[model samples]
Target: MTDERSSTSPDEQRSDPHDSSDGETADADATSDENDVNENDADGNDNADEFTIADFHDASQQEGRPVLTAAAVSRALELSHEEANERLEALADRGALERLAVSTDPVVWYPTELEDLTDRERVVVFPKQREIVVDRPDQFTRAQLSQFAHLADANGEQGYRYVVRPADIWGTPHDSFEDLARTMRQALGQRSDALEEWVHSQWDRAHQFRLTTHEEGYTVLEAQSPEIMGNVARQKLDEEHVHAPISETEDWVREGSEAAIKRILYEAGYPVQDHRELESGEELPIELEVRLRDYQQTWVDRFAEAGEGVFVGPPGSGKTVAAMGAMAHVDGETLVLVPSRDLAQQWADAILEYTSLEAHQIGQYHGGRKEVRPVTIATYQIAGMDRHRSLFDDREWGLVIFDECQHVPSDVYRRSTHLQSKHRLGLSASPIREDDRQTEIFTLVGPPIGTDWEALFEAGFVAEPELEIRYVPWGDDEQANAYGSADGREKYRIAAENRGKIDEVRYLLSAHPDAKAIVFVDYLDQGRELSEALEVPFLSGETPHHERRRLLEEFRRNERDLLLISRVGDEGIDLPTADLAIVASGLGGSRRQGTQRAGRTMRPAGGALVYVLATRGTREEDFARKQLQHLGRKGMTIREQAVERGED
Candidate 1:
């Protein structure tokens, strides 16, 4: 099993009378942290005559606590409680460490010293590991990091961890290495030689190959050096994919093998830059009905500059509107691909509502409808069909949009990318998968082109949802025994379907009776049980499309404040604005699923809340934390609470 634990930040922990309030304090009174708490301390304590900032950092990370109370500091530093507080307060007085006082403990302390870090005090760079730890980074720093680094996790407080992956280096939206390097310096406030060298090498690797159109109107793949063109491209591809070598550094790519070539080279770690002079199709003028947000305009401008990109933002961050802005910029025939018919219809209505496109100008192609117009919305399944593919393949689409584009790597959705659209655009809040195929999403669609979620949240452009994981005790011994006797996924299933969650769900609904809420479940039986208990409608895949639409419409119109939905509500269903989201189960799903469920409530003006119900001390607890870690990484505070066997 994956080790992605649902571990919370130290301060978010609930005080338990049985456990030490300050982490092992009961056993650590006489024990020296030099040997017990920290591994790096053995070498460091002897090297320094006095305690250094690195010691504090090491102690905090080793103890898995961001903010420590006086007892922890006293134990780790081997000082008296009063002395530790005096020293910590002295540092705090000098603006080295910051402290927050809570009712449950003496003032908790931040390890870093702000006075020494300058304006970049919040950013900590570990060049050797290619990891960045930022503490309470500002919008500017977060924005700079988004340009070249991937947010790996957040401590659900002030701390964020970012990792610079190969895909991030390959898909950096900068025009040149100098610009990217400059951005790194700006974000970090200092140049890191090791990190910069690695980044430059990866940046250089991305430019080693380029795809350009020949004067004869066919595609040619060129390499930076003849050795790469032969040793890499030619060595990997056969005659079926590449026709012949145009030269030592160039290859004549066979027809209908462009996507294959791109995918192949991408897998080989050299992202081919597309510079081909492709078609713009027939001009179809369009205008946006609403004014674009500053960030949305930036997304459009970046796409227009890059010619292809995926809009990666939180759900309510207006990606659809930004896409319409892109359509207005492209001003040509567009093909929008969706995961479901409901999304197709939502896209049509959104296009009409947010843009100047008339009803006749837009059409939908799916199982129920087959209409093609300047702006055609089609399901990915229908477009991937052999018989129906021709309609899309024959069209000279100027722009192709993949909504919910996380499915692009799947076998069915992968085929839809075969359509020869000049400008490929993809839209997804989480462009991630449970498997390793996530990189192909970038290769096939485009590099991610959107601001950081925290930036949007900070600017009040999108409401940052408050996420909480509530651990409920089993309702009875029978269920607990069933969970204990079960094995593997069966155990997870038992925990997920715990009868206690039903009570928790009812409690949450009663607490927020006026708030529009969605209760999500994985299994039909669990959903039915919750539906019956709460007297709410259960909307699952088994529900007819028309009925589903009507229920969603009623929810959107504020006629219904509650609905129990299955996995079908996870994505692509245009779920209406909700102030509350409760995951009754399904924590075993992908991290993206948690984000999508929470995103249903992330509107601009309202206070968004998400509660995940995990059976206490069961496997569901870990799954709950791991799945929602994505949201935490995006700068949302996640709190945890343990419940009694009975209702409060």
Candidate 2:
């Protein structure tokens, strides 16, 4: 239970009460004049003695009524009556203290020069407790009080308050403030003790049994225990109330007996939580055997040590395998998040093969799959739909693994950002986004703990694809006549499916006849046309998942030479075979997209071949150049050529 109380700042209370009235302007002028006079008086007091609590109290007794008698003043200062009386008169003359009443029976003094009564009052009330009582009932109403009660209830054991009004309940004068204080005391009956008990229970639950002294230092207890209880415990010795400092509590807890502390906590209504640590002579599940590559091992170590961070690599860098291995090491549930439906199934199937765990223990939640695993793989799309329900359902993930973390910058991604998880591991082929929202990702997720595609390729973690940029010249008639009504996408599609390029696709197919060649196109229409012209199978977003899997399996087994694929393969999809790529269409100038597309061939199965066919003298070439720049900077020579010799 957290603390919820009206802890408004003293600055807020000290604001002028007449600020809303028309006379505020005149009051401000008067305050300014008084401030100037005070400054002048201060300047003239270079030789003046410093004011003491004695002088302040003497003057306070003089205000309104006799708050203090001469005998009380002598007792407070531990001085002779004549000596105290002479000192009081001297203080009154200097304006440090003033006489309140006409009769000198027992002249009480008050600090008349102190305009800010609240600060002086706080010095009396709070002192060493680091607490302040506002005692202002005029600012709150009945409904507000009820609301405050509700807030206190929500905050549970940490809330405390007292409310009082002037009704002569304590047999004191209405203007004396004693009746008001008595009412407040009645309202707050036993609340202070209740708060102390609550804090003691929390510390006992932390399982630190020793009641040791804590010096002044901040302590961050992960949970409640006896050491913590000791910190809050108060003792009375020789008319003094002494409490342990926070530092002492920390040291005592560190050396305390765990069992004794747990017992004390259980007695105090705070039971010790069972954090399942591995025990001696207790064999773990035999099915937990995991085999990891060197890179995967590095990632797991990094995640364990860093707590929360990202892991980046291109396709086939074994992100899923590393994540699953890390999950096997955790005691609680693991939640794996992927961007797309196809990738979700791929991950689930992969997890099943890696662990000897039951099929039901490895779950799948995505567009096309059913969720049944204790260690579930959920899609970001479904998780982002209705957040309150989703967050409530999946708040217990021990390790949250995000696949394709580049998509985290999207608006929909923020839905899962605040969900509490102590351990997080994000996987991305390319962590960089079109918009520089990497910082937001770092906050929501953790810092990127992995590398990009270029790093993976250089380390031989992935394959090195032979690059070729083929500039398929637009037909001479395309240059003479413009497709005026066509959108940019439509024009690119027309150019991609040009008959000459169709023949060139056949020529590329013929050149890599035995080797499996993938024809990568932009539009579905272009995929269909190219598949028909080359007499080969193709896959697109519209294709059912089952059929798509079957077709990819056949192609991977070297059953198909020319397989046409669309932008659906842009992400981390399984394309085990078909090394050669024919970039039939794409956005110009962004090497990131091009690099991702080319990465399709980087998986070390057979050799890789990239053939980017862009229409000559169009924005497609410019886009292709921009994409090639990222590769060229990484030491990949980008060679360009023309499909058919034509005039510029």
Candidate 3:
């Protein structure tokens, strides 16, 4: 009978989509006449001649057999195999029939009564009240499938019948179910109606809404209901009504509200999924070399316990090393954000030197190269750039370390907080901002987790700092008059640029001829003047990034004893080798800036010295005192030293 037809004939044989029960092929042809007689008798009419695909489906269901091969139906109906095959395929396309794979080359058609098909005949099953069944459950390992079944059984009683919470799944002591059901669904190659219902339920109850960024660099909330929209707009000010310029259906959040929206969602017990693809980072290749100091260890413990917060420590107190230790403890994909390219390089070097990460694993995402790896070191400027924003948009960082976190309150840099991270650590010598935006830091990064500098100095983790306030007389009479007359910004600049401060710089350099020192000035001109007069390298904002790196390397290598720096040196730049720091000028009355400069020389050495060259009996003295307040609170004594050049 098989050889009576051509090989290309539809009934001649092909692989069945449904795995046929054993010996069903021989029975299929034998039952053809019986099926036709039964169908005619059941209908009580002569409609066997006009039977359609729908009629075939109804007959199969009524006969309690949901699956059929095209050849069986063709023989039963006395029609050509080609016509029957085409009709069956059309029914399958219309959802009245389902096609299942039986072998590599053949498929069989089934009526959509999935539940009626026995375990032997069906490959997959979605039971309404019973556990899911799969005939070929070989997609996952037996152990994996067993674990999934266990979780399903446990959580099924907890009202999460179809959906699995990641935390609940991962929190249990089991092998990693990294992608949860998403992975399982992909492997199964089928979707359950129950799973779709669960997804819809989750979406309806989700407290966290996505603040997605459009191509124009704007962000908007994907609000589903009026209540959610109202909740989002509750804190918006009167002038900031929700706008929907993109579409009438969707409401747009104001620019820079992304962080606020995230905070809101987090507080409401809804963790927003940023829909970013995260790289599964590899394990560390090497172990750490230096053991953290006792205080540093305590701070790390606290940071790990809190999961997110700012770590405030004195300069030269090993904040960078502590941060690296935290990363090693977490041992995940880390993104370290810095204010400058120099600091980014410094972080990269620290990661390589201290952690198990190799040179290839550490990528610098700044001016020259933007390669992202297991450990990415990026600058705030680069992170805030619109073109570079995509690098952070869809990526998930396991640990995010913000060096000099005080800079994050600014509008340009605050956008860096939008990058999703599991754990956040903010490292800063002083998190105080001039604009009273320290609250914003607390909001973005958690509250300040601080270690006392006095305790660190007592423990010998950091050098004891000796503060010397040197009185330099104002040499420029015209500038002196301008300093007295000018208000606000001009007055501060005039006082900071006093030419007599250069004499103090010369004296400090002369005093510390062999010691490695950093001369910090507020203005670029002051730094240049001192650098040339003292015959040393000058680093400022205008200095090329490569040259700055070279100069820093030279200082580190002890090829240069004295180097001049500007405002750029106030933050996370590590100059551990420098034993002396001469503050030539500074921003008027910034305690944070002063503490950071003093910290520049506080690395554990024999001792550290900081000389504040200020014009006595002017606004400079008050500003200088304000800067000293940070150290004063730490119990470091400041001594007044009058610079009497000829007398000395």
Candidate 4:
């Protein structure tokens, strides 16, 4: 909300109304007060009439309150307290407002109607629960929360709930606790002594341990005090993590166990401050061919300070470009690790297109190719193998980058986290896991440096697609009977593969004939049937890499209008942006899968659409909602509609 308000009619405008001691002379008094709140003298509001019922919203916002006190209203509207209280009681009697009396306030007024809350945003803090709820928040509020809170859930319409987790406070990229507190006050619009005290204690908890490189070239883990070292660190750690105790508060960390040490300490309630000076490798000339956006530059600047971070942003938000920007900032030999050969190829192409890296200087070290140059791109599986580990041992890498970093906490994937570098970077739109090991992502890499997805949507940097979940009836009695008899996963699968959806898919594709689209199917049988019906090629795991490359290139160049893909296209392979996306099956997939498919059309040009199809009167309906819940949390609206059964 801004202090400066725009001038419009009472119904259209949100501004504080001038109160009159007496009716006809009130306009003159308002003019003299010169309240800038939503008044437009140029818009003929100069001859404004008496008070409007809607004007109370202006007073509420001006006073920075979700609920208004009579004193606050008096100060905002230039009226006496008695007049304000009388007006509030009248409005309550008219059913336009409600009043509540709390221990801290005598009485406060809130809108009886939800639409009456016309403030730019509404924020409610539950200090005891450590949660913040916001409705239709602006970019500034979202950015503030990302620093020290985790987005827990959203009501799918206008409300977002963020929970302040210990990890959030520990990994906060602030200079001091005072600065963090100031940001909290700004975001919350008020200070909570109880919440601030809890936050301060957590902030102190994060700084209780430190990891540093010693003068003799060994790593040391230090605690804030001897008691902490003995009680927390010493009791939690073992000889595998550290060689021995160097002192009461310092331990000589074992070689190659630095990551383990940090993880153990962090899990034990102390976050280790890493200050080891590592190699920046031999300098390699590099520069970004494209200009960095303001937020991308800020991310690079922050990472340059911390030496490690994950670039978390929605799909099509130019994360690869930002990674290139980070590479240019470091200007050293870089090793980029991806999840698949397709992504490795995409990374190599992006580095070439956006950076001044020579083609010959870059190499791919996967099953298809094994060349390690100054700038190498390899798959995570290969790079972590004991045999392939020797390939990277000789050449010092200044930076190690992980694409699709949500996989970093897995058993095999975590092996690659042991790789030492001066800088570490990870990229993922959704860095979540079913096992709840997401915290390991931060400990393995670094704190997250991300742009709020809403910021990008508002700035038109990414399109917020029109998302709809359409539930279709079963094609025939046979399929309906089969689903009714089955239970558990089989029942869900039968519902998801409902034959009725074929016609719905045909209808949607026919309706948007000019729009480029991708239809995602989970099983091979369903994919083949849809491919045959739509007369489109289905790309799946069985498709040859070269053919996948050819079809994706055609799609990117706009030569192909429609394509069918399997779960393989959910991630790892960068499918070209489409104008429409249809989930023909697999509504029960993971939340990441749903978002990855919806994100195919989330480009800056807008006018994107995503249709999720589920069988009506089955568990598939619930599965569809559950799958897209992550997008709901990210501020995307999900509309639901029922499909009419075709004439039997």
Output the number of the lDDT-best candidate.
4
Q: How does each model score on lDDT?
A: 0.80, 0.53, 0.62, 0.81
* True lDDT of residue 441, candidate 1: 88
Tell me which of candidates 1 and 2 scores higher on TM-score.
Answer: 1
TM per prediction: 0.81, 0.53, 0.57, 0.83
Off by over 4 Å in 3: 1-286, 476-488, 587-589, 644-648
Clashes of each: 1, 32, 13, 0
- Which runs of model 1 end up more than 4 angstroms from their true locations? 1-120, 156-158
Model 2 scores what on Cα lDDT?
0.53
User: How high is the lDDT of residue 478 in model 4?
Assistant: 96
**Candidate 2 steric clashes:** 32
Cα lDDT tens digits, model 3, 1-648, are 011111111111122222333444345344444445554564686543444444564445444466777766776666588877887887777776788778743777776756543322222324344244333232122222332332132111121122244222321222233333433443233335574354334434442354455656555555555665455544432225345534432456665454575555544534333322222244544456666655566678866665666777777666777787678777777788988777878777766666666888888898878889878888889888899876675556678888889988899988888643357789887777878777567557655666545445654556667888887777668878878889987777778888888777776677766667888888887787777787777888788877887888887666666778888777646554467788888847588888878877665444568899878677788788776765665546677776654432
- Top-down lDDT ranking: 4, 1, 3, 2
Deviation in angstroms for 637 in model 4? 0.7
TM-score head-to-head 1 vs 3, winner:
1
lDDT of 3 at 534: 77
Model 4 C-alpha lDDT per residue in residues 411-454, reported as the tens digit of each score:
98898888643689998888878678988998899888887776
Off by over 4 Å in 4: 1-117, 153-158
Summarize candidate 1's per-residue lDDT along 34-101 as a digit string, tens digits. 22334344335764334445555655655667677878878876788987777777667766688888
